[model samples]
Target chain A: SQKIEQNSEALNIQEGKTATLTCNYTNYSPAYLQWYRQDPGRGPVFLLLIRENEKEKRKERLKVTFDTTLKQSLFHITASQPADSATYLCAPGAHGNNRLAFGKGNQVVVIP
Target chain B: EPEVTQTPSHQVTQMGQEVILRCVPISNHLYFYWYRQILGQKVEFLVSFYNNEISEKSEIFDDQFSVERPDGSNFTLKIRSTKLEDSAMYFCASSEAVDYGYTFGSGTRLTVV
Candidate 1:
């Protein structure tokens, strides 16, 4: 069975600091990985998608690193603000596979 | 930016009753999907629809479940006999291609009482 894991504990970060989160998977090699931000009572909003061949991807103040060898991916939010607080989810899937397996997600709280 | 839209933000239903959740995917998108999230759990895939037929479905999508693109634009998920365990937030998503990032709808919160 494929499994995806993330930190169960919520990350409390000071505003303007960088917040980092990790997502680890087992028993699968996905061709692409996606990160999403989900606010309470709302559906997930797609943030970034990185392929296995890409070591790093950046968008504005967000950065994501994919290390297929370690079966891990790191997500970073630089200069975080209070509005940046939300639960972040990571989903990984194969090229032909239509469904994406999502992790439970890691919550981030940016304190002012 | 195109967005997938789902109707009936929340619905409370009795057990053993039938319920149909509806969605209107992006016009230009060819692939549509149904996913659900139970309370605090991960989003689970229910089924995928393309060209007016089901392409793939999960075990969770048993005989009790059925999907349809009735009028070419509206996609629907029908539960024959809803069970208490069927309560979850059902989301509709669409993508231009299988590998593309999907745009998800706000979701319909179904509560089987």
Candidate 2:
């Protein structure tokens, strides 16, 4: 079975610290991995996308890296602020159509 | 930029009853999709639509489920008979890129009693 795993425990870090979240999968080689930020009662918002061939992708303060050999993707938020507190989700593209498999997501808290 | 929009932000339906969820996708998007998230769970793909028909669908989208783009703007999901397990947030999304960049709507919360 294909599975995407993320830490279930909430992560708390001081404001201005870098926040790191991990996503790992098993059994399938994904073409690309994507990261999204979702707030309570809101839809998941698109953040960044990285292909398996690409080592890393960055957008403003957000950075994502994909290591297909290890079947893992790391998401980092630099100089994190309190407002950056939200659940981050990792979704990997499934072969064939445009379907994707998503991790349960990791909730992060940036304390100011 | 125009975003996807779903109607009746919240819906309550009786189990065994038929229900239809409606959505209006972004005008320029070529691909459409439906995904569901059970409370406290990851979003799961239900079906994908393109070129005026369904391109792909998951096992969760069984015979009881059907999708249609009745008009240029309106896309709908019809549940032949709603079940308790069908209760969840149904989200409509659109993607223009083959790489699968999607813009999602706020979602319609369906509660089956």
The TM-score of the first chain in every model comes to 0.99, 0.96
TM-score: model 1 vs. ground truth: 0.98
Give all TM-scores, in the order shown: 0.98, 0.97
Q: What tens digits encode model 2's per-residue C-alpha lDDT throughout B1-113?
A: 78899987999999999999999999999999999999999889999999998988999999999999999999999999999999999999888875766888999999999
Number of clashing residue pairs, candidate 2: 0
Candidate 2 lDDT by residue in tens digits, A1-112: 9889999999999999999999999977888888888888777888988987899999999999999989999999999999999999999885564777678999999999
> Which number leads on lDDT?
1
Candidate 1 yields a Cα-based lDDT of 0.93
Chain B, model 2, TM-score against the native? 0.97
Name the fnat for model 1. Answer: 0.67
Error of 1 at A78 (Å): 0.3
Candidate 1 lDDT, A12-100, residue by residue in tens: 99999999999999998999999999898888889999999999999999999999999999999999999999999999989888777
Residue B13, candidate 1: C-alpha displacement in angstroms: 1.0
Give all candidate RMSDs, comma-separated: 0.9, 1.1
